[model samples]
Target: MIRKLFLIASLLAPLPAGAEPLANKLFAAEKSPSTQESMPIGTYAKGCAAGNVELPETGPTWQAMRLSRNRNFGQPTLVQFLEDLSVTATKIGWKGLYIGDMGQPRGGPMNSGHASHQIGLDADIWMLKPASLTLSRKEREKISSVAVRSADQRSVTKYYSPQHAALLKAAASDPRVDRIFVAAAVKIAMCKTAKASDTKWLQKIRPIYGHDTHFHVRLKCPAGASLCQTQKPSVSDLSKGGNGCDETLAYWVSDAYLNPPKPKPSKKPAKPRPPVKSARTYVLADLPSQCAAVLSSR
Candidate 1:
């Protein structure tokens, strides 16, 4: 029957593909190169260029994993940042540098899987654990460093080793780092340290909460690349207890100005009833006795 044939065809139909891959569609929106001379380099410009530098492939523990070579700053830059950080730590006599997550293209949007990890400019470095420190069962339980199954998830903790602190300092000191996330207390500590070190880049470092378990370093996007989605610092909501540290920070809840005012509770008027029509009247003598009796009873 036609119904059977239709059912078979429906079952055989191919499934629709998901959204277009980012690697293929990126840079399609960029305008053609201009003939004008390049702009002069500034402090932020230096930071952007340093952030875009290509990194090596080998890591201390993990191998470099790239999504696409054609994609700008995909895996190479991330690996380079790691290698540079490791090298910096070694120069300072610190050891045990391990990268947590990098270069995850299939992860979900921001706030999900390592979204920062998607663009290849972001990385999560694990907290350093020294071999000399003896940890009781309870103390070990307090330290957070779990094995992540996917390349997108990151662990959160409240503790940081001195070595970890050094690595964070090095990254924040680098001109390539646009922003770094650590603990609130650690940020305050870094501010004091930065003031003592006479390094202006450390003065530029901003601290946030809940990143004590790992370090999240984000780099500025490179020239002519649309894959990077670096956000400029905005005004913070000081009213909500968030330190509005950045300039031009706007109150996120400013939409209260546009919201409709609450309606006042008022008493409702009673509904009117329909007017009833009087029954047709007839002279008592002209009406039939039964009908007249019924009407009289009504």
Candidate 2:
């Protein structure tokens, strides 16, 4: 009976492990107000945040989903950006925006969900606009957003619309946003639809994996945040302020998309792979040195 109860409880929890470390648990469970001085430390994929703020669950034109995850947290700038972007989206014929995960309360590697939202600058906005801005807590928890891509992962489905492109453009146009990640099909659609004058914002819209259901927004390292690490821009990144439609979009639709080459077979039998470690198993040493201080602080 005890074993069955344990199994039932585990299924209800989102974390991969039954128990986490002291420091990991502390940072994960914090729900206090953000510190006055916002500081981001390290790159998006591997970093931590200080003075994180929580986005209100319900806003005038937006509602945050997945409240159980406790991930609706980020720097002050990120929270403000979402609120402002949602209002912008409403003005352009979009119903409203449904926000997904932002970052942890303190912003670090989470036990699950994402590898990049470790910094407070990253946020995920569901592609499916809510029917109403005021979603109840129960509805937010039960509702699931539909993916924009088809099963083959090659193109956008019927769920996509011109308003989707407008919504993305509005977010990209913000000076605070560094880049946005969407599925290849979404990027292709935007390239074909956006006006030439709006192509500059489209350049910041990058193609990444598993973004058909929602788009990922990354903010620039805020000024005065000296400790924050910025990602090195690729040489082809809007080179001389040119549009990205020619080469990058073409690659997603080429033969590489339909038939990828099989890996070369090894002559010797494959060795047994080692067991993977879950995020909960990670110790203080696995994280950046500065993260310890961030976790220990109020």
Candidate 3:
């Protein structure tokens, strides 16, 4: 019958509406935070933040860069930590700090760059100690952070200064900070000058790729934040009680690491499987279930 054929065709046709939109797109559309109580749900790279507060575009000692991204929002604790760190910058003889991306208005996967900022606890503090905090929004967009690591990634550049080390020391030493990510060379440079007996804080400064321009700061889950997940502690048995200054650290800066040999061609075609999704391709269902409630909230 005609009705049967129509039903069969309907069943065969693709239903775009049934396929949910990506979490990044949904979250990116949100220009404000949820009304729910503050909470960082799930892991850093695969979660959503509720009840985030915006850091003022311009502060007395800091200016949030890339204002047009509208990513100056974070949890209350994160905002406070940045404010305090800006003051710390002044004490270290720097003018102040040039803060970078904190999180989206309602923390979730962003349209581009950074996976860990999905939660409200991570922020990027620029290496360039602010030339001036009074810069206009347009200037903030064009002004670039200084690269402290060399192009070869083996050493720190001339731009690296004593005050820069002081800032890192202060930030890593903070109790509120869970960890800080910087270029391996920067960590190596810091390792060279650190007191032999006082390298405990250095343990928190992790070596990672492409953080020469700015350091990424991740804060601890605040007290009684039941929904928050704490990142696993660093496992570096590289030195005396693992301060990460041993030969193991050198591997990251070696030529082998910078230019590894290309893999040999496979004899057989690789089996296709679901690729690991990153922030760029995350969907609503890929995030925590409570995120639905958060997104739906007024």
**Per-candidate TM vs. native?**
0.46, 0.84, 0.91
Candidate 3 per-residue C-alpha lDDT over 148-233 given as tens digits, one digit per residue, 9 for 90 to 100: 99999999998899999999999999999989999999999999999987898898999999798999999999998888999888
Please state the error at residue 187 of candidate 3 in Å: 0.2
Local distance difference test scores for all models: 0.41, 0.80, 0.88
Candidate 1, superposed: residue stretches over 4 Å from native: 1-74, 105-112, 130-162, 196-199, 235-298
What are the clash counts of all predictions, listed in order?
2, 0, 0
- Of the two candidates 2 and 3, the one with more favorable lDDT, higher being better, is 3
Query: The CA-based lDDT of model 3 is what?
Result: 0.88
Is candidate 2 or 3 superior in TM-score?
3
TM-score, predicted candidate 1 vs. hidden true structure: 0.46
Better of 1 and 3 by lDDT: 3
Number of the top TM-score candidate: 3
Error in Å for residue 70 of model 1 = 20
**C-alpha lDDT of residue 146 in model 1:** 34
- Over 201-293, each residue of candidate 1 has an lDDT whose tens digit, in order, gives 543345543455566677665464443345666424334434423321211112332254787876996688886421111122222222112
Q: Quote the lDDT for 237 in model 1.
A: 38
Q: Per-residue error at 34 for model 2, in Å? A: 5.9
lDDT of 1: 0.41
